[model samples]
Target: MDLQKRFDKLKKLGLCDRCLGRQFARLGYGLQNYERGAILKESKEIHKNIFSQENIPQDISPKDDCFLCRGFFNKLDKYEKMVIAALTNYEFNNLLIGTRFPQNIKDKEKEIWEVCGDQYIEPIKTEFNRLLGKRVLKRLDVTVEFNNPDITVLVDLTKDKVELQISSVFIYGQYNKYSRNLPQTEWRYKNQYSESIQEIVQAPFVEASKAKEGKFHGAGREDIDVRCFGKREFVLELVAPKKRSIALKKLQKQVNMIQDKVEIFNLDFTVKDKKKELKGKRANKIYRALAVLSKGIEEKDFKKLKQIVGTIKQDTPQRVSHKRAKLTRKREIYKIDYDKLTSKKIDLTIKAEAGAYIKELISGDEGRTRPSVSQILGCEAKCKRLDVLDIEK
Candidate 1:
C-alpha cells in the first residue's frame, strides 16, 4: 500500500511518534523512527494543505496511534535528561546505548507486529536506542562505539520507566608479587580490606595515568602463599580510561613503593584491537621452590634426579582434580638446578611450560605426578615455599 494508506490504517489504531516512525525505520540513518514518522507526518500535513483546493479526500487523520511504540516517542526529552543525570560523573568518549523494555511493552510490540504481518514495524529496542543515542550524542558530544566502547549506556524503558547501564573499564599489565602472605589480587573482608585487586591497582593508575578504573588479568594465578619473584605476565585493562601512554617505569616504581611485595613489569598501552592476540599468546615461566624432604636424603640422590631434567612425561596432580577433570598432560622439564639450603631443605629452580604445576612437581602428590622430586629421590618431598622466578614471552 502507499504511505498514505499505511498512515491511514495506523492512525485508526492510534500510533505514537516512536511507533509511527518505526514503520520506516530502515529508511534512515542516525534518526529515530519517531522523528522519522513525525517528519513524514508533517510532510503529509503540508501536502494536504497544498492540495486542499482540489477536493481530494484525506485518508489519514492528523492524530495517530502506534501499536508498537505507544506514545513513548514524545517522551524522548525526558529520557535523555535522565540519562544525562546518570552520566554526570563518568568521562567517556565512545558509548553504546542499549534499551530494555518491560515484558508487557515488548509483548504489545510483538502483538502489533504480528497483527500487521510483521511488515514494516521496527523492534522497540532499536527505536528507543536510536532516539536516545542521538540525543546523548548531541548533548554529550560523544560518539557511539559498537565494538569495545568505552561505556555502554543502557536504557530500560519498561512501564514508563528508564534505566541506564554503565560499562566497565579494562586495563592490561603484568604484575609480580615479590613476597608471600600477600594475595595475588585483593583481599576482602567485612571488617578488613574489602577492596578487590582491581581497586588497589586502579587507584594509582587513575591518579598517575589519569585513567579510569583498572582490571587486572594474568596468564595464571598463584596461591596466596606463593610469591612471584620474576615478572608475572599480566594485562591491566583500564575501563574508559581518560589517558593513555602511561609512564610504565615510573608507574612501576610508584606501585612498588605502595606495596613492596608487588612489582609490575612490561607495562604498555593496549587497545581493544590487541586483546584477542594478548589472550592467545603463550609464554614460558620459571619457578623457584623451597623443597623439604620428609626424611633425610643423600645429596647424591638429588644429583641423580637432575640427570632426567630434559625428559618429558605425563603428570596428573590429585590436589586439583576436583576443579579439573582427570587428564594426562605432557610437560617437559627444560632445566633444573638445586641448592642445598640445609640437610633436610633445598631450593629447587625449574624452567618449564606455562601450566606445569611447580608445587605438585616437588611434592609428587602421592605418586599421582611422575618424574617428581619425591619419585626421583625415592623419598617423600614437599614444597615449603614456592615463588615464580621469571616469565618470558
Candidate 2:
C-alpha cells in the first residue's frame, strides 16, 4: 500500500499517532514517532481523505486501545517515574535501561513484525528503551551508557517492579603483609593471633565507599606463615557503593593504619576487567627462607644445594592435600643460592616459577617434591621463616 493508504488504514483502527508513527519508523530521520504521527495526522493528503479542517484536530488521539502497542507508549510516563524513583537511592552518572515485558506484549510485537515485514517499523523494546533513556537524560541529567554503565535499571512491566543493578567499584593496589600469621584472605579456620588480609583491608574500604559489602582479589596467595616483603598486587571490589568518589591517597592512608597486619599502597580506582587480567598473569617470585637442618652442613652442602635447580616435580603438599585437590605440578627453580648462618641453620634465597611451593621444595614434603633441599643435602630440612622479596613479571 502507499503511505497515504497505510496511514489511513492504521488510523481507522484507533491507534494513537505515537503508535501509528512507529509503524513507519525508518521512513524519516531526526523526528520521533510521536512527531511523525502528528505530521501525518495533519498532512494535506491525510486531511483530504479524512475530513474538513475544523472537524479534524491537529493531533490524532486514540479513541480505543492502540492496535500495535495496546497503549504501552501512553504509559511511558508511569514507567519512567518508577525507574526514576528506584534510582534515587543510588549515585550513578550513567545508566542502561532493561525491560521485562509481558508475554502478550511481546506476542503483539511479533504479530506486527510478521505483518509489517520489520523494514520500517521499530521493535517495541527498542522504542521503549530509547524513550526511557531520553526521558531519564532530560529529567535526571544522566547519560545513557551503552557500554560499562554505572547502573543498570530493569523495569519489570509484568510484575510492575523496578530493580537497580549497580556495578561494583574496583580499587587496585599493592599490599605488603608484615604479619606472618595473616592469610591472603579469610581462612575457613580461625587464628587467634591475627586477622585475615581480607578482613583488615575490606573494613576500611566498605566504610570509605559506603558500600554494603567488599571483597579482596589477590594476584596470588601466600601461606599463613609466609610474610610478603615486596608489594604484592591486589584489587578490592566495593559492591553497590553509594559513594563512588573517594580519594585514593586517603584510602591508602586509612588502610595503612592497620600497619601491624597489612599495608596497601598505590591505591587507585580500577575496573572489574583488571581483576581478570591480574588473575591471568603468572610471574616468577623471589623468596628468602630461613631453613633449619637436622644435622651440621659442611661447605660441600652449598654446592649440593645449587645442583637442586631446574624443573622439579611437586605433588600437592600433604598439609594442604585435604583442602586442595591432589595433583602433581611441575615448576622450575631458576636459581637457588644459600648463605651459612650456622651449622644447623642456613638462609636460602630462591628465584622460582609461580606456584612453586617453596616450603615443600625445602622439606621435600615426604618425597612428594623431588630433588628438594632435604633430598639434595641428604638430611632433613624445614623452612623456619619465609619472606617474598620480589614478584617479577
List, residue by residue over 311-331, the lDDT tens digit for candidate 1.
545455676677787877777
Q: Scored by Cα lDDT, where does model 1 land?
A: 0.67
**lDDT for residue 346 in candidate 1, whole number 0-100:** 92
lDDT of 2: 0.81
Q: By summed lDDT, which 10 consecutive residues of candidate 1 come out lowest?
A: 46-55
Q: How does candidate 2 fare on TM-score?
A: 0.90
Candidate 1 backbone clash number: 22
Query: Residue pairs in steric clash, candidate 2?
Result: none
User: Which parts of model 2 are misplaced by more than 4 Å?
Assistant: 1-14, 38-67, 190-194
Candidate 2 lDDT over 1-393, as tens digits, reads 465666655665555667766777776566667656666666645422333234335545543246566666677889989988988877888899988878887897677555544556787778888887789778999888889999999888778898888889999989888887777776543656456888888887788778989888999888888899778899999999987887778767877864667888788889899999889879899999999999998998668898878999999999988888999999999998889999889999999999999999999999999989999998999999999999874
Q: Which ten residues in a row have the lowest lDDT in candidate 2?
A: 47-56
